[model samples]
Target: MLAHRLACTDPPVNLLSRVQALMVDFFWDRMHWVPQSVLFLPKEEGGHGLVHLAGRGAAFRLRFVQRFLTGPADLVWRPVARALLEHCGGLGLAESLFLMDLKGLRLNNLSSFYGGLFNVWGLHRKERPECCGSLFWLLREPVVRVSRFVCGVGPSLQQRLCEERILTLGQVVEVCVGPVWTTLQAWPHV
Candidate 1:
Protein backbone atom coordinates (compact mmCIF):
# COMPACT_ATOMS: atom_id res chain seq x y z
CA MET A 1 0.00 0.00 0.00
CA LEU A 2 2.81 2.40 0.75
CA ALA A 3 4.26 1.66 -2.64
CA HIS A 4 0.97 2.35 -4.33
CA ARG A 5 0.53 5.59 -2.35
CA LEU A 6 4.05 6.75 -3.14
CA ALA A 7 3.80 5.72 -6.77
CA CYS A 8 0.46 7.46 -7.26
CA THR A 9 0.50 10.49 -4.97
CA ASP A 10 1.45 14.08 -5.73
CA PRO A 11 4.20 14.70 -8.31
CA PRO A 12 4.32 11.09 -9.46
CA VAL A 13 7.79 10.23 -8.28
CA ASN A 14 9.70 6.93 -8.38
CA LEU A 15 11.57 7.57 -5.22
CA LEU A 16 13.76 5.02 -3.44
CA SER A 17 11.17 4.66 -0.70
CA ARG A 18 8.47 3.63 -3.13
CA VAL A 19 10.74 1.30 -5.05
CA GLN A 20 11.99 -0.26 -1.85
CA ALA A 21 8.45 -0.73 -0.61
CA LEU A 22 7.41 -2.50 -3.76
CA MET A 23 10.45 -4.76 -3.79
CA VAL A 24 9.87 -5.66 -0.16
CA ASP A 25 6.24 -6.54 -0.77
CA PHE A 26 7.06 -8.43 -3.91
CA PHE A 27 9.91 -10.46 -2.38
CA TRP A 28 9.82 -10.62 1.45
CA ASP A 29 6.06 -10.69 1.90
CA ARG A 30 5.85 -13.49 -0.63
CA MET A 31 8.15 -15.80 1.34
CA HIS A 32 5.94 -17.07 4.16
CA TRP A 33 8.24 -17.52 7.19
CA VAL A 34 11.80 -16.54 6.37
CA PRO A 35 13.65 -14.26 8.80
CA GLN A 36 15.13 -10.91 7.82
CA SER A 37 18.55 -12.55 7.52
CA VAL A 38 17.60 -14.81 4.56
CA LEU A 39 15.44 -12.27 2.76
CA PHE A 40 17.85 -9.32 2.83
CA LEU A 41 21.19 -11.00 2.28
CA PRO A 42 22.48 -12.30 -1.04
CA LYS A 43 23.04 -16.07 -1.36
CA GLU A 44 26.76 -15.36 -0.89
CA GLU A 45 25.96 -13.94 2.51
CA GLY A 46 24.67 -17.41 3.51
CA GLY A 47 20.96 -18.05 3.09
CA HIS A 48 19.17 -20.29 0.64
CA GLY A 49 16.35 -17.74 0.98
CA LEU A 50 14.14 -19.64 -1.46
CA VAL A 51 10.86 -21.03 -0.10
CA HIS A 52 10.83 -24.74 -1.13
CA LEU A 53 10.96 -26.63 2.15
CA ALA A 54 10.25 -24.55 5.22
CA GLY A 55 6.99 -26.09 6.42
CA ARG A 56 3.89 -28.14 5.68
CA GLY A 57 2.68 -26.24 2.64
CA ALA A 58 5.52 -23.90 1.74
CA ALA A 59 6.17 -25.75 -1.54
CA PHE A 60 2.87 -24.58 -2.92
CA ARG A 61 3.66 -21.03 -1.86
CA LEU A 62 7.13 -21.16 -3.38
CA ARG A 63 5.70 -22.48 -6.65
CA PHE A 64 3.29 -19.57 -6.86
CA VAL A 65 5.98 -16.99 -6.10
CA GLN A 66 8.28 -18.67 -8.61
CA ARG A 67 5.83 -17.87 -11.37
CA PHE A 68 4.67 -14.38 -10.39
CA LEU A 69 7.56 -12.54 -8.76
CA THR A 70 8.51 -11.50 -12.28
CA GLY A 71 10.42 -8.23 -12.27
CA PRO A 72 12.62 -8.13 -9.20
CA ALA A 73 12.81 -11.87 -8.79
CA ASP A 74 14.35 -12.16 -12.20
CA LEU A 75 16.90 -9.51 -11.32
CA VAL A 76 17.82 -11.16 -8.03
CA TRP A 77 18.21 -14.58 -9.67
CA ARG A 78 20.63 -13.37 -12.33
CA PRO A 79 23.51 -12.61 -10.01
CA VAL A 80 23.06 -15.87 -8.15
CA ALA A 81 23.18 -17.76 -11.45
CA ARG A 82 26.30 -15.94 -12.55
CA ALA A 83 28.00 -16.78 -9.31
CA LEU A 84 27.06 -20.46 -9.60
CA LEU A 85 28.09 -20.66 -13.21
CA GLU A 86 31.42 -18.95 -12.52
CA HIS A 87 32.15 -21.32 -9.67
CA CYS A 88 31.37 -24.41 -11.76
CA GLY A 89 33.38 -23.28 -14.80
CA GLY A 90 36.21 -25.75 -14.48
CA LEU A 91 34.33 -29.08 -14.54
CA GLY A 92 33.11 -28.42 -18.14
CA LEU A 93 29.65 -29.83 -17.53
CA ALA A 94 27.91 -26.71 -18.90
CA GLU A 95 25.21 -26.79 -16.21
CA SER A 96 25.55 -26.57 -12.43
CA LEU A 97 23.34 -27.78 -9.61
CA PHE A 98 23.00 -26.32 -6.13
CA LEU A 99 21.37 -27.79 -3.06
CA MET A 100 19.90 -24.94 -1.04
CA ASP A 101 18.95 -24.58 2.62
CA LEU A 102 15.33 -24.85 3.73
CA LYS A 103 14.45 -23.89 7.27
CA GLY A 104 11.85 -21.65 8.86
CA LEU A 105 9.51 -21.32 5.88
CA ARG A 106 5.76 -20.67 6.02
CA LEU A 107 3.08 -22.46 4.01
CA ASN A 108 -0.01 -20.21 3.94
CA ASN A 109 1.09 -17.99 1.07
CA LEU A 110 1.00 -19.50 -2.41
CA SER A 111 3.08 -16.82 -4.08
CA SER A 112 6.09 -17.26 -1.82
CA PHE A 113 6.09 -21.01 -2.23
CA TYR A 114 5.94 -21.21 -6.00
CA GLY A 115 8.19 -18.20 -6.42
CA GLY A 116 10.96 -19.96 -4.59
CA LEU A 117 10.72 -23.02 -6.86
CA PHE A 118 10.91 -21.00 -10.05
CA ASN A 119 14.00 -19.28 -8.70
CA VAL A 120 15.63 -22.63 -8.01
CA TRP A 121 14.75 -24.09 -11.40
CA GLY A 122 15.70 -20.90 -13.19
CA LEU A 123 19.04 -20.59 -11.46
CA HIS A 124 20.04 -24.17 -12.26
CA ARG A 125 18.90 -24.01 -15.88
CA LYS A 126 21.16 -21.07 -16.65
CA GLU A 127 23.96 -21.65 -19.19
CA ARG A 128 23.28 -25.35 -19.06
CA PRO A 129 24.13 -27.38 -22.15
CA GLU A 130 20.63 -28.69 -22.38
CA CYS A 131 18.24 -25.94 -23.34
CA CYS A 132 15.08 -27.82 -24.29
CA GLY A 133 14.89 -29.73 -21.02
CA SER A 134 13.39 -27.19 -18.68
CA LEU A 135 14.73 -27.35 -15.17
CA PHE A 136 11.14 -27.43 -14.02
CA TRP A 137 10.85 -31.18 -14.62
CA LEU A 138 14.37 -31.98 -13.41
CA LEU A 139 14.07 -30.21 -10.06
CA ARG A 140 10.56 -31.48 -9.61
CA GLU A 141 11.97 -34.92 -8.88
CA PRO A 142 13.51 -33.96 -5.52
CA VAL A 143 11.00 -31.26 -4.64
CA VAL A 144 8.12 -33.67 -4.83
CA ARG A 145 9.91 -36.04 -2.47
CA VAL A 146 10.88 -33.58 0.26
CA SER A 147 7.47 -31.95 0.34
CA ARG A 148 5.86 -35.23 1.47
CA PHE A 149 7.90 -35.37 4.67
CA VAL A 150 7.95 -31.66 5.54
CA CYS A 151 4.18 -31.46 5.17
CA GLY A 152 3.70 -34.50 7.40
CA VAL A 153 1.33 -35.95 4.86
CA GLY A 154 2.33 -39.41 3.49
CA PRO A 155 4.12 -41.13 6.27
CA SER A 156 3.58 -43.68 9.03
CA LEU A 157 6.84 -42.55 10.62
CA GLN A 158 9.73 -43.57 8.42
CA GLN A 159 12.79 -44.75 10.34
CA ARG A 160 15.22 -42.87 8.16
CA LEU A 161 16.23 -39.46 6.97
CA CYS A 162 15.90 -39.38 3.21
CA GLU A 163 17.67 -36.79 1.07
CA GLU A 164 17.75 -33.96 3.57
CA ARG A 165 20.56 -31.98 1.92
CA ILE A 166 18.39 -31.69 -1.16
CA LEU A 167 16.33 -29.20 0.82
CA THR A 168 15.36 -26.01 -0.94
CA LEU A 169 12.13 -24.33 -1.88
CA GLY A 170 11.92 -26.98 -4.60
CA GLN A 171 12.77 -30.00 -2.47
CA VAL A 172 10.35 -28.83 0.19
CA VAL A 173 7.64 -28.91 -2.42
CA GLU A 174 8.77 -32.38 -3.40
CA VAL A 175 8.55 -33.64 0.16
CA CYS A 176 5.38 -31.82 1.11
CA VAL A 177 3.28 -32.30 -1.99
CA GLY A 178 4.88 -35.23 -3.79
CA PRO A 179 1.77 -37.27 -3.22
CA VAL A 180 -0.44 -34.87 -5.10
CA TRP A 181 1.82 -34.85 -8.11
CA THR A 182 2.24 -38.58 -7.95
CA THR A 183 -1.44 -38.96 -8.56
CA LEU A 184 -0.95 -37.13 -11.81
CA GLN A 185 1.94 -39.30 -12.94
CA ALA A 186 1.24 -42.81 -14.14
CA TRP A 187 4.64 -43.99 -12.84
CA PRO A 188 5.08 -41.91 -9.73
CA HIS A 189 8.00 -43.03 -7.59
CA VAL A 190 7.24 -43.79 -3.95
Candidate 2:
Protein backbone atom coordinates (compact mmCIF):
# COMPACT_ATOMS: atom_id res chain seq x y z
CA MET A 1 0.00 0.00 0.00
CA LEU A 2 2.74 2.45 0.84
CA ALA A 3 4.45 1.79 -2.48
CA HIS A 4 1.17 2.12 -4.35
CA ARG A 5 0.13 5.33 -2.61
CA LEU A 6 3.53 6.89 -3.20
CA ALA A 7 3.38 6.06 -6.91
CA CYS A 8 0.15 8.10 -7.19
CA THR A 9 1.17 11.74 -7.74
CA ASP A 10 -2.04 13.65 -7.07
CA PRO A 11 -2.36 17.41 -6.20
CA PRO A 12 -0.90 18.76 -2.94
CA VAL A 13 -0.71 15.30 -1.50
CA ASN A 14 2.55 14.48 -3.22
CA LEU A 15 2.67 10.73 -2.55
CA LEU A 16 6.14 10.45 -4.07
CA SER A 17 7.56 13.05 -1.71
CA ARG A 18 5.91 11.41 1.26
CA VAL A 19 7.33 8.04 0.22
CA GLN A 20 10.77 9.55 -0.29
CA ALA A 21 10.63 10.98 3.23
CA LEU A 22 9.52 7.65 4.66
CA MET A 23 12.30 5.84 2.80
CA VAL A 24 14.86 8.24 4.19
CA ASP A 25 13.54 7.78 7.70
CA PHE A 26 13.48 4.00 7.32
CA PHE A 27 17.00 3.78 5.90
CA TRP A 28 18.75 6.18 8.30
CA ASP A 29 16.66 6.29 11.46
CA ARG A 30 15.13 2.78 11.65
CA MET A 31 17.49 0.67 9.60
CA HIS A 32 18.59 -2.67 10.99
CA TRP A 33 21.25 -5.05 9.68
CA VAL A 34 18.93 -8.02 9.41
CA PRO A 35 15.23 -8.51 8.87
CA GLN A 36 13.53 -9.62 12.10
CA SER A 37 11.18 -12.02 10.33
CA VAL A 38 13.85 -14.51 9.22
CA LEU A 39 13.61 -17.67 11.34
CA PHE A 40 16.66 -19.65 12.38
CA LEU A 41 17.22 -23.37 12.06
CA PRO A 42 18.75 -25.70 14.64
CA LYS A 43 22.55 -25.74 14.96
CA GLU A 44 22.35 -29.06 13.13
CA GLU A 45 21.59 -27.60 9.70
CA GLY A 46 24.53 -25.22 9.24
CA GLY A 47 24.38 -21.53 9.98
CA HIS A 48 21.74 -21.49 12.58
CA GLY A 49 20.22 -19.97 9.44
CA LEU A 50 16.69 -18.70 9.01
CA VAL A 51 13.88 -19.19 6.51
CA HIS A 52 10.93 -16.86 6.67
CA LEU A 53 8.22 -16.03 4.20
CA ALA A 54 8.25 -12.23 4.10
CA GLY A 55 4.78 -11.48 2.72
CA ARG A 56 2.36 -12.46 -0.02
CA GLY A 57 5.00 -11.40 -2.54
CA ALA A 58 7.50 -13.57 -0.75
CA ALA A 59 4.97 -16.36 -0.67
CA PHE A 60 4.70 -16.18 -4.45
CA ARG A 61 8.41 -16.95 -4.68
CA LEU A 62 7.76 -20.36 -3.23
CA ARG A 63 7.66 -23.38 -5.57
CA PHE A 64 7.49 -27.14 -5.47
CA VAL A 65 6.49 -28.55 -2.03
CA GLN A 66 8.18 -25.69 -0.25
CA ARG A 67 5.90 -22.97 -1.66
CA PHE A 68 3.06 -23.40 0.85
CA LEU A 69 5.45 -23.43 3.78
CA THR A 70 6.46 -20.79 6.33
CA GLY A 71 9.16 -20.52 9.02
CA PRO A 72 12.31 -22.64 9.36
CA ALA A 73 13.14 -26.35 9.36
CA ASP A 74 11.94 -26.81 12.90
CA LEU A 75 8.41 -25.87 11.93
CA VAL A 76 8.32 -28.23 8.98
CA TRP A 77 10.89 -30.90 9.87
CA ARG A 78 8.49 -33.27 11.55
CA PRO A 79 9.35 -36.90 12.41
CA VAL A 80 5.85 -38.08 11.58
CA ALA A 81 6.37 -36.78 8.07
CA ARG A 82 5.39 -39.56 5.67
CA ALA A 83 8.67 -39.96 3.79
CA LEU A 84 11.65 -38.70 5.80
CA LEU A 85 12.20 -40.14 9.25
CA GLU A 86 14.76 -37.54 10.31
CA HIS A 87 12.37 -34.61 10.76
CA CYS A 88 10.44 -36.00 13.70
CA GLY A 89 10.41 -32.71 15.55
CA GLY A 90 8.18 -30.17 13.85
CA LEU A 91 8.37 -26.38 14.19
CA GLY A 92 5.61 -23.77 13.97
CA LEU A 93 5.19 -20.02 13.27
CA ALA A 94 5.65 -18.10 16.55
CA GLU A 95 8.02 -20.49 18.33
CA SER A 96 10.42 -20.62 15.40
CA LEU A 97 10.68 -16.82 15.44
CA PHE A 98 12.33 -16.91 18.87
CA LEU A 99 15.65 -18.08 17.43
CA MET A 100 15.72 -15.36 14.79
CA ASP A 101 19.06 -13.83 15.77
CA LEU A 102 20.92 -16.91 16.92
CA LYS A 103 23.63 -18.37 14.68
CA GLY A 104 24.55 -21.79 15.88
CA LEU A 105 26.01 -24.91 14.22
CA ARG A 106 23.78 -27.77 13.11
CA LEU A 107 25.08 -31.33 13.68
CA ASN A 108 22.93 -33.16 11.10
CA ASN A 109 23.95 -34.07 7.57
CA LEU A 110 22.61 -32.24 4.53
CA SER A 111 20.37 -35.13 3.44
CA SER A 112 18.76 -35.28 6.88
CA PHE A 113 18.33 -31.52 6.89
CA TYR A 114 15.94 -31.09 3.97
CA GLY A 115 14.12 -34.38 4.48
CA GLY A 116 10.88 -32.57 5.11
CA LEU A 117 11.16 -30.45 2.02
CA PHE A 118 11.94 -32.64 -1.03
CA ASN A 119 10.94 -35.93 0.53
CA VAL A 120 7.42 -35.20 1.82
CA TRP A 121 5.54 -35.82 -1.40
CA GLY A 122 7.26 -39.04 -2.40
CA LEU A 123 5.08 -41.07 -0.10
CA HIS A 124 2.27 -41.30 -2.64
CA ARG A 125 4.50 -42.59 -5.43
CA LYS A 126 5.54 -46.19 -5.40
CA GLU A 127 9.19 -46.80 -5.98
CA ARG A 128 9.79 -47.94 -9.54
CA PRO A 129 12.96 -49.83 -10.40
CA GLU A 130 12.72 -48.86 -14.07
CA CYS A 131 12.57 -45.13 -13.32
CA CYS A 132 15.64 -42.95 -13.60
CA GLY A 133 16.61 -39.94 -11.55
CA SER A 134 16.01 -36.40 -12.77
CA LEU A 135 18.79 -33.84 -12.50
CA PHE A 136 16.61 -30.92 -13.58
CA TRP A 137 15.46 -28.35 -11.07
CA LEU A 138 11.80 -27.41 -11.58
CA LEU A 139 10.16 -24.02 -11.28
CA ARG A 140 6.75 -24.14 -9.59
CA GLU A 141 5.19 -20.97 -10.96
CA PRO A 142 4.34 -22.53 -14.31
CA VAL A 143 2.82 -25.57 -12.68
CA VAL A 144 0.71 -23.46 -10.35
CA ARG A 145 -0.38 -21.03 -13.04
CA VAL A 146 -1.30 -23.84 -15.41
CA SER A 147 -3.28 -25.63 -12.72
CA ARG A 148 -5.23 -22.52 -11.78
CA PHE A 149 -6.01 -21.79 -15.38
CA VAL A 150 -7.16 -25.33 -16.10
CA CYS A 151 -9.09 -26.00 -12.90
CA GLY A 152 -10.58 -22.56 -12.29
CA VAL A 153 -12.49 -22.39 -15.57
CA GLY A 154 -12.25 -25.59 -17.66
CA PRO A 155 -14.71 -28.37 -18.27
CA SER A 156 -14.55 -31.09 -15.62
CA LEU A 157 -14.55 -33.72 -18.35
CA GLN A 158 -11.81 -36.07 -17.13
CA GLN A 159 -10.54 -36.14 -20.68
CA ARG A 160 -9.85 -32.45 -20.74
CA LEU A 161 -8.82 -30.55 -17.61
CA CYS A 162 -8.64 -33.36 -15.07
CA GLU A 163 -5.37 -34.88 -16.26
CA GLU A 164 -3.94 -31.43 -16.75
CA ARG A 165 -4.87 -30.35 -13.23
CA ILE A 166 -3.33 -33.46 -11.63
CA LEU A 167 -0.17 -33.03 -13.63
CA THR A 168 0.05 -29.45 -12.43
CA LEU A 169 -0.71 -29.58 -8.67
CA GLY A 170 -0.26 -33.29 -8.05
CA GLN A 171 -3.11 -35.57 -7.01
CA VAL A 172 -4.27 -32.95 -4.53
CA VAL A 173 -5.56 -30.87 -7.43
CA GLU A 174 -8.33 -33.38 -7.98
CA VAL A 175 -8.46 -34.97 -4.51
CA CYS A 176 -7.48 -38.34 -6.01
CA VAL A 177 -4.25 -40.39 -6.03
CA GLY A 178 -4.47 -42.54 -9.14
CA PRO A 179 -3.26 -41.64 -12.62
CA VAL A 180 -4.24 -38.15 -13.79
CA TRP A 181 -6.37 -39.73 -16.52
CA THR A 182 -8.60 -41.57 -14.02
CA THR A 183 -9.79 -38.59 -11.99
CA LEU A 184 -11.22 -36.48 -14.77
CA GLN A 185 -14.83 -36.22 -13.59
CA ALA A 186 -17.15 -33.88 -15.43
CA TRP A 187 -17.45 -30.54 -13.67
CA PRO A 188 -20.11 -31.34 -11.07
CA HIS A 189 -21.98 -28.06 -10.75
CA VAL A 190 -22.01 -27.25 -14.42
Candidate 3:
Protein backbone atom coordinates (compact mmCIF):
# COMPACT_ATOMS: atom_id res chain seq x y z
CA MET A 1 0.00 0.00 0.00
CA LEU A 2 2.79 2.39 0.93
CA ALA A 3 4.66 1.55 -2.26
CA HIS A 4 1.54 2.12 -4.34
CA ARG A 5 0.92 5.46 -2.65
CA LEU A 6 4.49 6.54 -3.26
CA ALA A 7 4.30 5.46 -6.91
CA CYS A 8 1.06 7.39 -7.38
CA THR A 9 1.60 10.55 -5.33
CA ASP A 10 4.41 12.60 -3.84
CA PRO A 11 3.80 12.36 -0.13
CA PRO A 12 4.92 15.15 2.21
CA VAL A 13 8.52 14.58 3.30
CA ASN A 14 7.89 16.12 6.71
CA LEU A 15 5.28 13.45 7.55
CA LEU A 16 7.65 10.68 6.60
CA SER A 17 10.49 12.28 8.56
CA ARG A 18 8.35 12.67 11.64
CA VAL A 19 7.37 8.97 11.58
CA GLN A 20 11.05 8.02 11.25
CA ALA A 21 12.02 10.32 14.11
CA LEU A 22 9.37 8.85 16.38
CA MET A 23 10.61 5.30 15.75
CA VAL A 24 14.19 6.35 16.48
CA ASP A 25 13.11 8.08 19.70
CA PHE A 26 11.23 4.98 20.85
CA PHE A 27 14.31 2.84 20.37
CA TRP A 28 16.55 5.39 22.04
CA ASP A 29 14.33 5.59 25.09
CA ARG A 30 14.60 1.85 25.75
CA MET A 31 18.34 1.64 25.22
CA HIS A 32 19.71 4.93 26.42
CA TRP A 33 23.40 4.08 25.91
CA VAL A 34 23.07 2.37 22.50
CA PRO A 35 24.30 4.50 19.62
CA GLN A 36 21.72 5.04 16.86
CA SER A 37 24.16 3.63 14.30
CA VAL A 38 24.09 0.32 16.17
CA LEU A 39 20.50 -0.22 15.06
CA PHE A 40 21.55 0.00 11.41
CA LEU A 41 24.63 -2.23 11.75
CA PRO A 42 24.67 -5.86 10.64
CA LYS A 43 23.77 -8.52 13.23
CA GLU A 44 27.28 -9.98 12.99
CA GLU A 45 28.50 -6.57 14.11
CA GLY A 46 26.29 -6.82 17.23
CA GLY A 47 23.43 -4.60 16.03
CA HIS A 48 19.77 -5.09 15.23
CA GLY A 49 20.21 -4.42 11.48
CA LEU A 50 17.07 -2.39 11.24
CA VAL A 51 16.44 -0.60 7.97
CA HIS A 52 15.71 3.11 8.03
CA LEU A 53 12.28 3.67 6.50
CA ALA A 54 13.23 6.71 4.45
CA GLY A 55 15.98 4.77 2.68
CA ARG A 56 13.64 1.83 2.25
CA GLY A 57 11.01 4.16 0.81
CA ALA A 58 13.50 5.51 -1.70
CA ALA A 59 14.46 1.96 -2.63
CA PHE A 60 10.79 1.06 -3.03
CA ARG A 61 10.32 3.98 -5.40
CA LEU A 62 13.26 2.86 -7.50
CA ARG A 63 12.00 -0.72 -7.49
CA PHE A 64 8.59 0.48 -8.58
CA VAL A 65 10.14 2.35 -11.47
CA GLN A 66 12.16 -0.71 -12.44
CA ARG A 67 9.10 -2.98 -12.35
CA PHE A 68 7.11 -0.54 -14.44
CA LEU A 69 9.85 -0.61 -17.04
CA THR A 70 10.68 -4.34 -17.08
CA GLY A 71 7.41 -5.90 -16.01
CA PRO A 72 5.34 -7.97 -18.47
CA ALA A 73 3.69 -5.83 -21.12
CA ASP A 74 0.45 -7.82 -20.86
CA LEU A 75 -0.23 -6.51 -17.39
CA VAL A 76 -3.48 -4.59 -16.98
CA TRP A 77 -1.70 -1.32 -16.20
CA ARG A 78 0.73 -1.64 -19.10
CA PRO A 79 -1.51 0.17 -21.57
CA VAL A 80 -1.79 3.13 -19.20
CA ALA A 81 1.96 3.20 -18.83
CA ARG A 82 2.48 2.76 -22.58
CA ALA A 83 -0.01 5.47 -23.37
CA LEU A 84 1.76 7.75 -20.90
CA LEU A 85 5.10 6.96 -22.53
CA GLU A 86 3.70 7.49 -26.02
CA HIS A 87 2.08 10.77 -25.05
CA CYS A 88 5.46 11.91 -23.78
CA GLY A 89 6.77 11.44 -27.36
CA GLY A 90 8.20 7.90 -27.56
CA LEU A 91 10.75 7.99 -24.75
CA GLY A 92 12.48 4.76 -23.68
CA LEU A 93 11.39 3.66 -20.19
CA ALA A 94 14.76 3.64 -18.45
CA GLU A 95 15.94 6.90 -19.98
CA SER A 96 12.80 8.67 -18.80
CA LEU A 97 13.37 7.37 -15.25
CA PHE A 98 16.99 8.55 -15.35
CA LEU A 99 16.04 12.05 -16.48
CA MET A 100 13.45 12.26 -13.73
CA ASP A 101 16.16 11.50 -11.17
CA LEU A 102 18.57 13.95 -12.81
CA LYS A 103 16.09 16.82 -12.84
CA GLY A 104 15.05 16.14 -9.21
CA LEU A 105 11.53 15.63 -10.46
CA ARG A 106 9.16 13.29 -8.67
CA LEU A 107 8.97 9.86 -10.32
CA ASN A 108 5.19 9.94 -9.90
CA ASN A 109 4.92 13.00 -12.11
CA LEU A 110 3.71 11.95 -15.60
CA SER A 111 5.44 14.85 -17.35
CA SER A 112 8.86 13.99 -15.90
CA PHE A 113 8.40 10.27 -16.54
CA TYR A 114 7.23 10.79 -20.12
CA GLY A 115 9.90 13.42 -20.81
CA GLY A 116 12.71 11.13 -19.71
CA LEU A 117 11.31 8.17 -21.66
CA PHE A 118 11.05 10.32 -24.78
CA ASN A 119 14.63 11.56 -24.35
CA VAL A 120 15.94 7.98 -24.30
CA TRP A 121 13.78 6.95 -27.22
CA GLY A 122 15.05 9.91 -29.23
CA LEU A 123 18.68 9.02 -28.45
CA HIS A 124 18.33 5.38 -29.53
CA ARG A 125 15.97 5.93 -32.45
CA LYS A 126 17.67 4.69 -35.64
CA GLU A 127 16.47 3.57 -39.03
CA ARG A 128 15.83 -0.15 -39.04
CA PRO A 129 17.71 -2.00 -41.75
CA GLU A 130 15.66 -4.05 -44.20
CA CYS A 131 17.54 -7.09 -42.92
CA CYS A 132 20.02 -7.85 -40.14
CA GLY A 133 23.40 -7.05 -41.69
CA SER A 134 26.35 -6.57 -39.33
CA LEU A 135 26.82 -7.84 -35.78
CA PHE A 136 26.92 -4.17 -34.84
CA TRP A 137 23.15 -4.18 -34.91
CA LEU A 138 23.22 -6.53 -31.90
CA LEU A 139 24.81 -3.77 -29.87
CA ARG A 140 22.15 -1.24 -30.91
CA GLU A 141 19.30 -3.59 -30.13
CA PRO A 142 17.97 -2.64 -26.69
CA VAL A 143 16.52 -6.07 -25.93
CA VAL A 144 19.62 -8.14 -26.78
CA ARG A 145 20.79 -10.26 -23.85
CA VAL A 146 24.53 -9.90 -23.14
CA SER A 147 24.52 -12.93 -20.84
CA ARG A 148 24.44 -15.31 -23.82
CA PHE A 149 27.85 -14.03 -24.91
CA VAL A 150 29.41 -14.05 -21.42
CA CYS A 151 28.38 -17.64 -20.57
CA GLY A 152 31.87 -19.06 -19.92
CA VAL A 153 33.26 -16.00 -18.13
CA GLY A 154 33.34 -16.43 -14.34
CA PRO A 155 31.28 -14.13 -12.14
CA SER A 156 34.39 -12.34 -10.83
CA LEU A 157 35.61 -11.62 -14.36
CA GLN A 158 32.14 -10.45 -15.28
CA GLN A 159 32.20 -8.16 -12.22
CA ARG A 160 35.57 -6.81 -13.37
CA LEU A 161 34.15 -6.22 -16.86
CA CYS A 162 31.18 -4.41 -15.31
CA GLU A 163 33.43 -2.31 -13.07
CA GLU A 164 35.43 -1.33 -16.17
CA ARG A 165 32.14 -0.15 -17.77
CA ILE A 166 32.17 -2.91 -20.38
CA LEU A 167 28.48 -3.70 -19.96
CA THR A 168 27.48 -5.23 -23.31
CA LEU A 169 28.78 -8.07 -25.51
CA GLY A 170 29.32 -5.46 -28.19
CA GLN A 171 31.61 -3.51 -25.85
CA VAL A 172 33.41 -6.69 -24.81
CA VAL A 173 33.81 -7.70 -28.45
CA GLU A 174 35.15 -4.27 -29.29
CA VAL A 175 37.52 -4.06 -26.30
CA CYS A 176 38.47 -7.68 -25.53
CA VAL A 177 38.88 -8.87 -29.14
CA GLY A 178 42.26 -7.12 -29.21
CA PRO A 179 45.20 -6.87 -26.76
CA VAL A 180 42.71 -7.27 -23.89
CA TRP A 181 42.78 -11.06 -24.49
CA THR A 182 46.17 -11.06 -22.76
CA THR A 183 44.60 -9.23 -19.82
CA LEU A 184 41.83 -11.86 -19.68
CA GLN A 185 44.44 -14.64 -19.70
CA ALA A 186 46.25 -12.95 -16.83
CA TRP A 187 43.17 -13.06 -14.58
CA PRO A 188 43.80 -15.40 -11.65
CA HIS A 189 42.04 -18.78 -11.66
CA VAL A 190 39.09 -18.94 -9.26
lDDT of the candidates, in the order given: 0.39, 0.32, 0.52
Summarize candidate 1's per-residue lDDT along 16-71 as a digit string, tens digits: 44654665567666665767557665577786443321221333333333433333
Candidate 1: regions farther than 4 A off: 1-74, 77-132, 135-137, 143-153, 156-163, 167-190
Root-mean-square deviation per candidate: 18.3, 19.1, 14.9
Q: Show how many residue pairs clash in every candidate, following the order shown.
A: 28, 13, 5
Residue 180 error, candidate 3, Å: 33
Clash-forming residue pairs, model 3: 91-117, 91-118, 92-117, 96-116, 96-117
Q: After superposition, how far is residue 153 of candidate 3 from its true place, in Å?
A: 43
Ranking by TM-score: 3, 1, 2
TM-score of each: 0.20, 0.19, 0.44
Supply the TM-score for candidate 3. 0.44
Better of 1 and 3 by lDDT: 3
Most TM-score-accurate candidate: 3
* Candidate 1 global CA lDDT score: 0.39
Candidate 2 RMSD computed on C-alpha atoms after optimal superposition onto the true structure: 19.1
- Candidate 3 residue-wise lDDT, 39-136, digit = tens: 78889999977667656655555555556666666678667765665333223333222222223223344664343343333344245555766544
